[model samples]
Target: MIEIKNLSKAYKKRKVLHHIDATISNPGIYAVLGPNGSGKTTLMKICMGLVLPDEGDVYIYRESVRASIQYRRMVSYLPQIARFPDNLKVKELLQLTEHLRGKAQRKEMLMELLDLDPYMDQLFRNLSGGTQQKVNLVTCLMYDVPLYLLDEPTAALDPVTQIRLKEFIQHERERGKMVVLTTHVPHLVQAIADEIFFLLYGDIYFHGSVEQLIGAYQANDVEEAIARLLMYEQEKVKI
Candidate 1:
């Protein structure tokens, strides 16, 4: 449902993404992996039209992202950072989000699953960091959209909540929804990601199934493979 071709982006003299190309035509979770300053976030932003590309274009459902915004209706995005008016209560924030989206939300079950009932009347800023991340997940995942873009979704979530989030991801995949996530959690990638895209130095270093990632790097595990990829980059600089 998403196609990126020859995408490139830069800030002044520094490039963040370089001629990246990929397509997602199936329903499953795709994990974008990269170290800091590797352009993972920039790639996601270009897809959402939050940042314009210096070259190439992103297409969603046969429409070019640079041309129109109507394609966003089919997308649900959860940013890396969740920010809101600190004075707003949890329920108020949710209500405002629904009103802005103009769509019926499936929030009740998610709220219960996340154990957010006690915080309904509490100010958003008063909640703990983990609680805020849970609320963030509820606000994004409770929507019925063709594509879900989550950046650092498991951040600040406890072990229990992380398990719950994985369950939700699996449910969506079975229901024919596409989830593209950016996470450094190795276990999360091995658990839910059907495809993994590793970004290195503004380019796609690797894009394949999780098994392929392991096999290509010849590592016994995901962590080892990731380390190898990082070291590979360092060696390139020394060359």
Candidate 2:
């Protein structure tokens, strides 16, 4: 479980995250949904211990992330965008990452599961965007980490590849790994997310099961549900 308590961040005295407190107990896919600049990325970075928060603590499995290298070892993260060495081949990149992670050999299970065989010899810069995403994802999942944090992981994939990734997420969840991701694609969220965090204006406006959102909003789909919530919020501010 991941617990965030009174978390906040500011840049040059301009606040981004407020005193946000959230608990992620459900060990399945949890989608963090938000528009641009809603502080989703900042929250993820803080949870991953990449960014320091001005106030509050992040706890993973009852351990403070900031104080324990062991806690960091149990987490896998795939950023929204990544840049690799332009001169490295796919194999070399994977090799380097695995070595750094202390995994001398690739996890054959993960490689086969993600269908990573096809691009082993391709240059990092030459692969298509979607393929690059696959590589990025593979690099993270290769480690037997308990927590997975992915940001907009399906942004550039085709329908087939997207479907494949959805399956992969489910598989990971079933293995008792906590999968948290941020996404703007409602369809993808509806398909895989057991819980949704609807963030607005740097706050978590709603956090509930996907079915709860659909029922509470009286919407037939996730998109409509999201639209209803946003519209209601807008009207509340107008009054």
Best by lDDT: 1
Candidate 1 lowest-lDDT run of ten: 97-106
Off by over 4 Å in 2: 104-106, 109-115
Candidate 1 lDDT over 78-179, as tens digits, reads: 888898887999999999989888654689989998899999999999999999988888888778889999999999998998898899889999999999
Q: How much lDDT does each candidate structure score?
A: 0.90, 0.84
TM-score per model over all chains: 0.97, 0.92
Clashes of each: 0, 0
Which pairs of residues collide in model 1?
Answer: none
